[model samples]
Structures are given as structure tokens and as C-alpha cells.
Target: MDGGRDSEIAMGAYQPGYLATRNRAARGQVHGFRVALWQEHLGRDAAAEAAGDLLQPSSLACVRRMNQVAEKHWAMFADDSFRGDLPGHLMAYPVGVGSGGELLNTRDKFPDTNAKVLGTKSNILPPILTT
Candidate 1:
């Protein structure tokens, strides 16, 4: 698949793949996702590594290593994603008619919604800035 990029594209990689991208489109009018890293699932050595990696001066290596820890916790708590133990109903939403409502539970559905909310001219900031 052409160095796996084609697969990523096929799987909707061209979309707003990060929270920052979505927030930028909304002109900073967005509250970003809250990521609580639950380290109980990490073993002693891995936990130590994560702590050291996270505490180090911000760098690509530190960020990358911590991201691996986040990924592990996310996989374990996909339904909650570190929002604490919420009831099932709190995590569920009704599917809109014929709108692939089944996908609302997925991370890929926000781009279209963001476009509708922020792409409109009505949502634009005025060209002139005043104190």
C-alpha cells in the first residue's frame, strides 16, 4: 500500500487527524479532549519509564514515548478514555437517521461536524480587530 500511506488515506487519514487540527479550524473556539493517563495498567518498569519520559524536557523522544503509554491506556479504556467510570448510557448517543449513526462512536465523525460549525461565514471573526 505504497509505504502504508495509501492505507492511511483509505482509512480517512486526510481528515482532521488530531485535536489541534479541529481546534484550529474552530478558531480556538473549542475545548480539547481531556486525556487522563491511567498508569495503573502499566507495570513497574514501564511506569518508571513513562514517568521519566514524561518528566524530561519536552522533546520528540519524550512525547513519542508517552504517546505509547497513552495508546495502551486508551485501548484498555476505549469506552471511557480516562473520563472516569461512566455509565454506559453516558457514553451512548442516538444515531441520526441515514447519517451512518453507527459511526458517531468513532473518532472520524468530527470533521464533517466541524466544517458545518466553523466553515460557515457566520462563524468567521470580523476582519478588523479593535481593543
Candidate 2:
């Protein structure tokens, strides 16, 4: 994994006053693992072979494990049995920083070219004008 991608994942593992966002990250991790398994063990180009391999007992077990972990985390987020005091400070700090970091990282990867096109203009025209 790229250092930048890993850092973004780490930052996303938190949300203000709630751990639900971390659960979302966990789900993404499972998907990543599935993608790796598909690319490596079954080969990305071999769709038929991948399907066959996924039917095997070992593959089934791996799928089951991933599903179980995802279910557990999802339940934590969905459940609202308790109505105790919220962790305001804990929620505010981590969620904001983590979300901001993610936004910065994403923007770094794909910059807004509108600024370059518009130049010093206070109001720029639509993309259609440039095309």
C-alpha cells in the first residue's frame, strides 16, 4: 500500500462522538483484502477461474471470516440501545482532523484545475466555455 493511502486510511478511522466511521473503514479494509485475493490468487484477468476458485472451501472460509467481521462492526454502528452522554470533545477532535486529512489527501491526488484555467479572475466561466 502507498504511504499516502495508508495515512488516509488511518485518519478515516475516527469520527466525532462516534466510532461508526471506524466501522466504515473496517468494511473498506475487507474489500481491499478481497481485491488483493482476487488479483493474486485467482488473477485479475481470469474471471472464470476466479469464480471457480472462489467456490472452493478455503475461499468460502475466507469470505465467511470477512463477512463476520463486517457484520460485527456494522452492528456496533447501527445499534442505539443506550442513550448515555455523548463524548463531545472526543468526537469533535478526531473526526474533524481525520476527515480534513482525507480531504487534503484526495485533493492532492486530483487537484482542481479550475484555478489554473480561471487565472486571476474573481468569477470563472463554466467548463463548457473552455471546451
Candidate 3:
């Protein structure tokens, strides 16, 4: 018998292995985005002003990098070579005094990488609030 049947008998649950794998892939994508964001923002050693221009916290480039990471995760998920699903976990951010401020999601915040890779505009906003 396949492992799926054994798992079901042992846990008294019917696990959707395919769906679980897909979810894992999705998580991987999100993780990639986090890494890309960090690299784009903190990977440089330039002056503050120059870095500001290149790595705007809310620029499209930054967002694109995040999306690219997600895409890679998706690819890995679709690949049959990976038997298990990707792990589900949240991407953590460093907290500081000035770090918790809200970022304005404007068109400028969309990364150019979206157009280059995904071939369309990416709706990557985490939901907006007006106060």
C-alpha cells in the first residue's frame, strides 16, 4: 500500500498530498520574495542618498524581486522531482523604533521585474487601510 493509505489509517484523516505540496510551493515563493526584498534593500554599501534612489523601500523593483522569489517557489512546487510540499512559514522582519511605520503602496512600489518575468502588473498589495 502507498504511504498515503497508511497515513490515513494511522491519523484517521484523509490528507490531500497534492494540495499540501502546492501550498508548500506557495510558501516557498513567499520566502523567496522576502529574501529578494532584503537583498535589494540592505545588500548595498552605497551612501544613504544613493541607496535611497536605488532601493526605495516601496519601489516596484523591490516588489518584483519578491515576486520572482515566489515564482521560483511555484516552479519548484510544480516540479515532480520534489516529493514533499514546501514548508509553511511566515517571513519575519526586523523590528526597530522607526521600522513599524506603514508603507504607501503606489504605482512606484511595483517592481519592474513583474513586467519582465510575469509579463503583467502584479497585484501584490497586502491590503490598504485609510485612517
Q: TM-score for each prediction?
A: 0.27, 0.22, 0.25
Clashing pairs in 2: 16-91, 17-91
Off by over 4 Å in 2: 7-58, 82-131
Cα lDDT computed for each candidate against the true fold: 0.37, 0.36, 0.37
Q: Give lDDT tens digits, candidate 3, residues 1-131.
A: 23433222221323244223422332344444544545453333312323333334356865555444444545444455776644322121221133567443222212323322212333773322111
Model 1 per-residue lDDT at 24: 39
Root-mean-square deviation of each candidate, in angstroms?
Answer: 17.5, 19.5, 19.6
Clash count for each candidate, listed in order shown: 0, 2, 6
What does candidate 1 score on TM? 0.27
Residue runs of model 3 more than 4 Å from their true location after superposition? 1-55, 84-131
Report the C-alpha lDDT of model 1 over 21-73, residue by residue, as the tens digit: 42233212121211112233344455566564543324586667655655554
Instruction: Name the 10 consecutive residues with the lowest summed lDDT in model 1.
Output: 27-36
Best by TM-score: 1
- State the local distance difference test value for candidate 3: 0.37
Better of 2 and 3 by lDDT: 3
TM-score of 2: 0.22
List runs of model 1 lying over 4 Å from the truth.
1-45, 79-131
True lDDT of residue 80, candidate 3: 53
